[model samples]
Target: MLTPTTASPRLKLATAPLMLLIGGFVSLQSLINGELASRLGTGLRASVAAAVSSFGSGLVLLTLFVLLHPGSRRQVATLGRRLREGTLPPWMVIGGLAGGLFVASQGITTPTLGVALFIVCVVAGQSVMALVVDHRGWGPSGQTAVSAPRLFGAVLAVAAAVLVGLQAGLDPAGAGLGLLLALLPLVAGAGTSVQQGLNGRVAAQVGPWATTWNNFVVGTTGLLVFWLVTFALPGQLTAPPRDWWLYTGGLFGIAFIALSTVMVRIHGVLVLGLWAVAGQVIAAVVIDLVVAPEQLGVLSFVAAGLTLVGVVGAMTLRARGVR
Candidate 1:
């Protein structure tokens, strides 16, 4: 009863810009997460709690939207049938767990490392994992063999990540531990990337709205379950600050996830991932320069330049089909 979906040219064209926008949302999240972590200071646990709260709020809003919108109701029913028939892959479900972990890691690490450093670390993880996933063609979209150009791009991305890391002012003693924690989200991000690819394929078979809602439904459920078990202790899962700005961040987070899901359907993971990283780098630089001027040293600029060059270079190579 399930059929594959295909993106029209217009949709494909839209993916690039949309991915870039999603990257901006991600950058905002970095700033917001760092601020929250600094205030809470419970380390990784606090980040986990924040992730739970943010996602939990998004889930509630999405549920309300589904109830209010007559069209969404139909989409949900259709998706339910797909779920019943086992049309969606199990691995895609696992993507939800990865998403939750990524959020928690961001909340914990961003304050210590700063947005620039945190993003680079996660991007390093994402680039390498994305290469492996693409090369193996292991996910829902089938294998899109890694060409030579793609491999080169991955190398460049890694180099960029390294440059950014070196400039991040990380303590040598804590670097190992920090890097390990950072990888949790990176791994989770890669899973989500793959999940997006698979979901894209399934979305084409179903409808985009259905695919988006299904992911939200599944991912939200996963987040809530993990949240309840992990942070049910006293004083955990408390509300964020009373400021409207904090809640604004939550709204942006919801929009970011929703839009990125749509982007994955059009651009494929490679483009989506690359553009998202690029946007984050730009945003982090701006934030650093404005919010924490001391962090924007000469090395930061150099590293940022190197990262931009690498991203551009990789993109050029991809365009030319060198990989």
Candidate 2:
């Protein structure tokens, strides 16, 4: 088996494009899941169904792939042995719960918030927490100090979120509820940093695919129970839609999660967050323009530019600092 690369401060330029691609997958997943929710049920029931469908489908797919791969099977056994020996902390494997929270939040709020607004809110939360994750050495790449460039980059990312939020122009009558639902994605966004950190740790031991499978296992199980309690008990459930596109959220999610599992170790939490957020902002902006051109504004485009600047500045400045 190939040994995992050690987390290093040196920038790996080759990985930048892949990180951006993964970020685009995130926004795409939200759009797909939100559409699924709209077609499936109402209120929280729709959210639960969307979340369960995405995670459950991904879990099934990953389970089959892992079971079929001999190397992955050995890795799973090794992970179990490490757990028994107390070499790997049990808490490290629970990162999927964080991913599940983000997914559930997307399902609940994305239809109402729209992809661009929802993604910016997530970027707001993620950019802040990623700084904390890196500074505290919680991520797999180890401690990355809160340097001026890093801090400024985070501020820029958050500022971009604020710009998008201002442009969103929520309805006056529904502003209160809108604000409340927006907060859910904000909190869920923060959890993504934690999720990436933990998953990166696990991925370093096994492979990205195996780590992703484990995430699906834990996330799908948790979402299933949440759906049972909240939607199933209240009799809010509805039959899932037959549309093939509605189910593509899981495939997009798997791509992003697996890619992120690898990228987090290379870029560290904060830089990775910025890069992903940059890509997410661009994708979200394009999507909003296509889907709801009436809502597009100068500020939205400006926010996207700022996000790109922030990501580039963060990576370049950090690399310079390291050198």
Candidate 3:
């Protein structure tokens, strides 16, 4: 039987920090994957290659775990039975396809739109969709009415992302092409809320490990198909470099997804997304400070601060509403 989505206070306290940490992992994964993509090849095809590598490597790792761990194997079997019985919706398993789209969009749009604009568009889509997903009870946590604070948090989260990249300035070189490409990440980001909700539903039935494995399976297959379609495109697939760190993106993704699968069932998608934004902002700031101190700006710190403020405000306000 599935566990209830309502979490105890203790669980809330424990999970919040974990969600933030998982968000940091997400930031790290993006860094690693972007580096990998830049190094492995060029053009959109190379982006697909990096994405495929991330998903495929994660799939292999999860596959090994399923083979070795009896508990995970049983959970997978149980989920299969539930699906066969029609107790679980089959559509939920396809959440990973959204993940595939999200990564692919990063490759397709970032060069044209610039990371600043892309992040803003993506965060905007994610924040808005998260509100709808939570309010409509699409996730395992059930319906959470959209309160003023929650709404504010969503807006603030987007603002924080925008603030972080304020100094970077959006590129206007390919305005027409960038606008079209921008839609890809916008839609893809919205899909992530759906992905989180679906993963939570699946995790409620089986477990996070099994749910994460299932995501990797679907995501890997989708990315593989994407790669094949782009195979004949005009781009060169450079041989994999010997740098070991480039290959760790998938491992980071595995951790992030598994942790998020568990956390989303407790906090709902909006709050979870806010917390994640906070973590990502903080981690990015830290990375900048360490890797290139000269480029770091005061606005980056301010953006990180605003993300935390948004998260805390939302949490406090939502808790009162529940009471």
Candidate 4:
């Protein structure tokens, strides 16, 4: 639902800003997912529950879409055939995997780091890996040759992670573990770029909501399998969440997936990612101020500024279009 509702007149503005606004929802989703995890008692169970909720909501939306625009259904009717015949890249569904992991990570990390620092780490990870993903052709944006600007971007992101991680470790016994946990999003966040690319490709063929439906199926299934195998371990599966807000993570997820599909297509991943970075940072800062203002300080802003600098540096050359 990246598209604006008829009743909502404020968001009918130009495309770029709208996309950035949508990007900020990813931060909100992290906050909600974290809450859901805290209620559920473990990241693993929380992730599975959230994925199921996301998939359930997605299924309902897709059903409505199919009912309203029966024509689009015809377009995707060949989705199965095409997937089997190799007409579509099998990896387009990677968005689901990326999403599942992201929610899981958010659940695992957000409480400890708070929304602002947690999102900063996610952005830091995404900024660094996006370069490699672009260069290696793992991303939907196609091959982007490695360059000085991109390298500088990566360095800045790493430095920003360290800056943020230092604060994250301040009260903990194992600062090293804190540092590692802060940077874990670096690896997890890279999947998002890949997911955007693949999901964008799917949107090109089947349409935006349809693409999300596909992602829901894949991501939910992947997490379900993981949950079945791992939930038996200690400190894994616990009680179900009681709060209504916890369930809203799926709705937030649906919004962002659709936004990424559109924005990544319109603006290349560089601009889209960076623009969304601004949105997430702004939202994260606001959320922290309202809820846990004490967690963020000078170091948080410095890390965020460094991440922004990295994003700008990466855009110095080519952060857009096919190479």
Best by TM-score: 2
lDDT of all predictions, in order shown?
Answer: 0.65, 0.79, 0.74, 0.71
Q: Where is the poorest 10-residue window by lDDT in model 4?
A: 3-12
Name the better of 2 and 3 by lDDT: 2
- Model 2's alpha-carbon lDDT is 0.79
Off by over 4 Å in 2: 1-16, 164-170, 232-235, 261-272, 294-299, 319-323
Tell me the TM-score of each prediction against the true structure: 0.81, 0.87, 0.81, 0.82
Q: Is candidate 1 or candidate 4 better by lDDT?
A: 4
Cα lDDT tens digits for candidate 1, 166-211 = 5543668877765565555456566655665566666656665566
| Candidates ranked, most accurate by lDDT first | 2, 3, 4, 1
Model 2, 1-323: lDDT tens per residue?
Answer: 11224644344667788878988999999888888887887868778889999999888888888899988888877878888998889899999998899999988887777787788778878878877887888877788776766677778878877776565545677766777776788789899878877877887887677778888888998898887777544435568788998898888987887777567667655566667878898898788778766655677677767777877887788768742
By TM-score: ranked, best first: 2, 4, 3, 1
Model 4 off-target regions past 4 Å?
Answer: 1-13, 89-92, 147-152, 172-176, 236-242, 264-266, 312-323
Clashes of 2: 0
Off by over 4 Å in 3: 1-16, 106-122, 158-170, 176-183, 261-272, 289-309, 319-323
**On residues 147-239, what C-alpha lDDT tens digit does candidate 3 reach at each position?**
677687678766765654453443366454545665676688799888878887898898888888888889889998878888778887888
Q: Is candidate 1 or candidate 4 better by TM-score?
A: 4
